[model samples]
Target: MTTHEPVQMLSARLALPLVRELRGLGHDPAPILKELGLHEAGLRPLEARMALASWLRLHAASIELSSDPAAPARAAARIQPDAFPIPLHLLGSQATVREGWRFSAPYLGVGIDGLRAELIPEETRSRFDFQVQGAPLGPAPLAEFFMVGLFAYGKRVIPSELLPDRVNFAHPRPAHADALCKFIPCTLRFGSRSVGFEFPTAWLDLPIRGADPQLGQLLAEQAAAWLSTHEPTPRLADRVRLWLARNLRDSDAVASRLARDMKLSERTLRRKLSEEGTSIRELVAKARQARASELLGSTSAPLDAIAFELGFSSVGAFCRAFKRWTGCSPARYRAEL
Candidate 1:
């Protein structure tokens, strides 16, 4: 079979949850990943870019491989708000659902390539629309996953009894339509021109559970930084910065490890970064400083926890570094914010 070339790219993190759900359903995701030239171990460096085609193929494969016709919807419904990648988390952190969609719509490209979200206000209802531009829409399962995922997330964040007045699907009605209804529990309109939902205008003002404006601002900054690297061809320095930013908590961010993961020798990686007017050390520091500012400005987490999350050896070390970056202690920075 001729494989389709990816015309656009998205964060690999989007596939991790879906792949986990497929495994839970007793389907082997390895074959599908292999078929699409993805790493058999799993999509790694969660922030690294993957072909949009591969993401859609994974959805299609889940439907084909699983005996359950509702596999995709089930998987999406199981996704908790905290399990969402940073972009979606950014959306949920807004003070209200309407504000969340309004703020997050532009940054959708940070996670899903070719996807655009629009919030349209009506007199009594507001419609949120999802559209794929500059690429094929892929299979029906892909559309279902997007729609269901959003609704499921909304239910978790919106304080009121959540139900869309109307849900629209671009794909034709499916044989397992009943399975979808069980999860959605609202009016479902298939064969629609768009994929999204309409809810009461009043619901738009409903407070999001655990909404934090500070955290939302921090996440928005991270999303903006990630979106900057999604150009047709990003600079090496920008790519390295993004990688370090995403992996600071889990990975060491050492030069050797970064080079190995990026498929380049240490010397070559250094040379390339130098060509781009940066070094590994400089990029690492930049990532640390940016994340430090975000954590300090956003949360009341103790300095020790923040230090650990930023991969520092100790609170003292992080404090010293924070002072170097901003001429003040982390606590002081938070105080000022």
Candidate 2:
């Protein structure tokens, strides 16, 4: 059996708090869930899993409905550690931030494939790296949520005032600069290589106030059992498809760039894809086709704009590609929708 690609599934527990918070804020969660072809029943059991594509759509939809651009960040700050499906009590029971991360980081992948956190020790400070491995389509909300969520969850276990002294994002600065300031109290930086946080290394060794070593042991055992079943062993083709979706806007994002992003060489990437009986070009075409269908059906974005988003230099070029892919023009596709 192959390693399940993280993109194929996302923990159902991830989206509900955001949805409920939105409902509490007076926005209907029904439209966004329906748009993503998800329903309340699917998110019923917090431990249940949902498609990664649908999870991305859920965050995107929440941002759309939240007129405030910093809404995701605000919602993330409000996340309670106790509510997470995975046992975060394990972290709280640990002695220090470093100990907690050593125990927690590996299992986090089981929750959200696209969101990975790295705890790096530096001379004077520690870096907490957050990233979405592939294409960075509409990244503001997710990035904000992930960064803010980390701090929110950390605040629960770490004794002192635990806040990021500096926060950075791989994506561009959002238009709602003032709102991000008002909502998230951190000093924010944008347009970096990855989303990350920097805080004093001293915080890493600071003793956790209420460590429950006994309960921690029990939870760790349970988590190990849980992970044995939920290992992140994604298939090669599915992983490629996800990468393609992430970089659809960059027309020049070919195999070499993709390989480098995935920390594989060009040769390895090719060998892996071929082993699965698909090539980079074929998988990328699949990504564009899926994206085109999504935009055409759900959004009223103009044909030219959609063309640019799909990385076509001109509307004519996009139209031709769309025709080749679906035997129809973008306009016709949208009209049929």
Candidate 3:
């Protein structure tokens, strides 16, 4: 007889709060639950993930129902549980910070939305870029909440002698600046590209004790069992979206190009996209239309220039595409606003 080890799953910390917020906004989450085929009891603590697609839908719906466009920011501030400063108990005997980071990455997603970690190596020091996707409701308040987590986690694993090289963010808030400096004695740059950490490359070379033979075997067994039940790959639409989002400025994002980027043969890519309820051409058109709207509303560039920039052959062609997308000509779109 074979005994299966129970798969351990952690919910993103704010998931519960977001659910409550949705209900508070007078929206019945039951329709969403039914659509996702999720059980009402799944909202209980310690439940396994109810499909990544389901979570994504809930996130999108919550944002749409929000009166403020930046609702994510506001929700983020109060998202984490009150018992928030969860200490980073060393996962085994990992000596280096990088190892600790890798161990925590999957688990960190439990509380964070749109969080990503990027590593940039430099001669003297390296930078770890932590970027969060989508602007939430209250930017200032959210920054504070995240800082609490960052500081608490950093202070535990990383020694006090070594400090972050710098802190960079997308918004400027004096209160946040003070709180950030209180924990990290480093320079803070606001309105920067993304959130990241900088440290010495030598740090990576530090041996990780947590990778001991015993722990390695244990973790491997645990991981193997988990993979047996999970989907284990990116959904088709998500892959296409990520690919196009990264390559939108290229202006030559043909289906073949996307196929190559995704490492799938063109025919295979088409088949997979078809299975996912979309096609490469439709995806590209959707991307361009969305980008066009954003640029038109956010920038003061001329219509012709904007069209040309988005890879249109001519201003007239762009106008036609825009009309097809939003049922309004570019001139009319501009006139209405």
TM-scores of all predicted structures: 0.61, 0.61, 0.44
Q: For residues 1-337, write the lDDT of model 1, one tens digit per residue.
A: 8976457777676676678778887877887788888874446453566776788778777777786778778888887543466667777888877788777777777667656665656566676666554112435776787678777777788767778877877678989999999889988888755577777788878888988889888888877777676644546775676578567876454888888878999999999999877898887777788667655643567999999988988999999998998899888888975
Cα lDDT computed for each candidate against the true fold: 0.74, 0.70, 0.56
Cα error of candidate 1 at position 94, Å = 1.5
What number of backbone clashes does candidate 2 have, counting pairs of residues 3 or more apart or in separate chains?
Answer: 8
The TM-score between candidate 3 and the true structure equals: 0.44
In model 2, residue pairs whose N, Cα or C atoms come closer than 3 Å (at least 3 residues apart or on different chains), thus clashing, are: 3-233, 3-234, 4-233, 4-234, 5-234, 5-235, 135-246, 135-247
In candidate 2, which residue ranges exceed 4 Å CA deviation?
A: 1-8, 30-46, 85-87, 132-138, 234-337
Residue-level lDDT tens digits of model 3 in 47-81: 24444445556666677887543343344434433
Q: RMSD of candidate 1 to the true fold? A: 18.3
lDDT of 3: 0.56
lDDT of 2 by residue, 1-337 (tens): 7885434566677677678767877988898888877777677564577776776676766677776566666777778653464545666677876787777665665566544565655567666665444433225665666667767777766667766777777777878766776545778877754467777788888887688878778767766776687765656766776567667888875877889987899899989989978888888776777667656754677888888878778889888988998898888877864
Give me the displacement of residue 62 in model 1, in angstroms. 2.3
